[model samples]
Target: MLRDSVTAASADRAARGRAARKRVPRSAHGTWIPAADRPDPVGLLQAQGRDRLPELLPVRYARMAASPLAFLRGGAAVMAADLAAQPHTGLTVQLCGDAHLLNFGLYAAPERPLLFDLNDFDETFPGPFEWDVKRLAASVAVAARENGHKEEHVFGAARAAAGQYREAVRRLARQGELTVWYQHIDADLLLPLVRSGRRRRRTEATLTRARRRTSLQALGKLTETVGGRRRIIHDPPLLEPAGAMDTASLRKIFSDYRSTLPEERRLLLDRYRFVDAARKVVGVGSVGVRCFIVLLSGRDADDPLFLQIKQAGPSVLEEHLPSGPYVHPGRRVVAGQRLMQAAGDAFLGWTTGPEGRAFYWRQLHDMKASADVAGMSPGELRAYARLCGTALARAHARSGDRVAIAAYLGGADTFERAVGDFALRYTERNADDHAALGAAVVAGVVPAAPGV
Candidate 1:
């Protein structure tokens, strides 16, 4: 069976290569995934996340099964599986496979500039652009439903997301590379859009809050002194303080990781000297995985930089992607993240943990935050959608075929309509899944988390 799978994958790669060569505008291999024969979205997610589902908060689990639409929206791996089964236009890159309403956010670029890009790369891989769009649109539809919008209103939001994506991609193609790079979604452009009749006062308030979100705030929350000692304290079953790890065991792991780093980075990091590290649970999907936040203090007390070393599992995008020479999943994530984000963390790096687990390291809380969906108005939603769309397009353009994609999209109308259709259909699917989850919770099939 393994041999057969390998052979089939090899054949697919060859076919994709040929197809890419024949196209009017050249593109990466296997970039497009036709919508006709996608996978059963729900089943795909269940399969990929089976081992970790029990570890998720029951409230989150309930929300996943709250409705078919909700389930479909949350089950990105499932969608990727389905998309992988279809024919595609063959534009490929390291995609943020689970791009959704909440995934877009603000971050510090390398030059200390604040920029926006896809914040999550857990599912990053070379995949079809449409798959990302479909997922994002569906998320809008489900999120709208979560906000109490009716079906028609939900579809309207999805349509709006699609329209924005179509227009934004084309617009970037016409701009100079430097101009596109310098461009950012600031508060000024959005205030008028929201203040006008198109948005609500409440939504404007949310954007106002998002604009204020920064890494400094994260540092304040995540960094604290414990028991008269300045340190990041442990929040049990979640954020475990470093003092919890067995020193002998950690020293062994750190020694191994040191070998993996380049000589210069290793030397630079060595100056801080390892105080301690802890196993932490982080993010919705990443909980229960082995995540460690290493605290390294240099000469001064304020010179402390916390680095989160998170385990890298197989890409949620693995099934759809053509295998390459990447030996470490962590490396794949780090590389893809650097390519996709306009500016990345200066300390971005990767290493293996004890037991050979792939892990990516980054400064914890270097001003990371997200948009609050519940606080957004209809107008704010639309403006945020445009921001995410343009960012997604730019990320893809950097790694894939911008010229071909732009030519195929031509103008936003046709593609937008197609995406709108898929989004509406998928949103219905999410509602169904969400409802199923609720049923499961009621039946005690899955325990419910407190928040729901």
Candidate 2:
């Protein structure tokens, strides 16, 4: 009787998913006509910068103006508004919110093997699952073009991403809840496909580099033996000493973040003693945000741990979608990351900082691995695109009604093909937006300092 009830519930959810097709047909997903009154993309970016450091706004523009892909990375707010304008599948899940090619990478939880998965979560929030998929597809299309892949390969890569996502979702929907819960993409899983000897060696080297990226490794690169003691190196405008007040504030908030961790982890953290802190600039989209690196010593001066504290603002999707369960943006990011990533950081925590800003903390590096999209060949790009799609599907399945979403996707290539079309169309729009930003920089409408 219990088994029968579970079956009945699944059937009902599947029916609801199918019913959604009538409201927004699969073909409808192919469209991307900007509304006649679409807001100017630059103006939208300017608005996003209002909360950022005014002195650093030019850096954001310069980074964004670097390429169409860079523009897309920093232009999540613009795309969020655009995606909100369209009809959705209404199949909700915790979204990566900015699921671009670069964002899906390899990293490991404390004392675990590396796994390739979604690593960025600053914009994470619950929303229609397709928003994440579409973002990934669009990014693949843009990167392929930037890499000089032909149009045929461009469409092929985009379609591969959508196709793998659909296939993975269908597979996950049939698995037991526990099976889905424990599923993870081993970072080495893609090795079987690298038939070329040289490429295989390069891939292995990349993985080895990722594994070596521990806190100890960070100690060497980010710190120096200053006046017979270790200190965070100062490289003004990028990395600088956090003034005395800021340093004290970070120390004060350490306890609050400690409270959010598991008891055992708290005991582990208590072993470390604060040493120094520094403000650091990071990422294309994340530039100008309040981010700091906290250095701590454990056991002895030789045993060091680095934790990054980044201010969390409302997600770009916040205005368009309903508010997420966590009111504190830092908590929302931490919670969303824990839910999506197969393995999580041992030190992941959140707290409110000076001026009531929400901030989240986690080990630096956290042992990250991201693809060099600029260096990938057409075939390499396609394979990586498919892997990202599968990772995204697994994350969505863990959080959403996988059976229903599988039903919505159906067993046809129709949706994937339509998404390919959407990718190309949106790529055109994205290129134009990128060009406008460049124009703004040239006309002095916006400040820009390239090569920073």
Best by lDDT: 2
Question: Could you tell me the lDDT of residue 255 within candidate 1?
Answer: 64
Looking at candidate 1, what is the lDDT of residue 248?
55
Model 2 TM-score, all chains together: 0.98
**lDDT tens readout by residue for model 1, 217-287:** 44466667667666665666566655544445556666666665667767877877665566676655454
- Collision pairs in model 2: none
* Clash count, candidate 1: 34
Q: Which ten residues in a row have the lowest lDDT in candidate 1?
A: 24-33
- List, residue by residue over 223-290, the lDDT tens digit for candidate 2: 89978999999888899999999999999999999999999999999999999999998898998899
Q: What is model 2's C-alpha RMSD? A: 1.1
lDDT scores of the candidates, listed in order: 0.64, 0.91
- Evaluate model 1: give its lDDT: 0.64
TM-score of every prediction relative to native:
0.79, 0.98
Q: Which residue runs of candidate 2 sit more than 4 Å off their true CA positions?
A: none
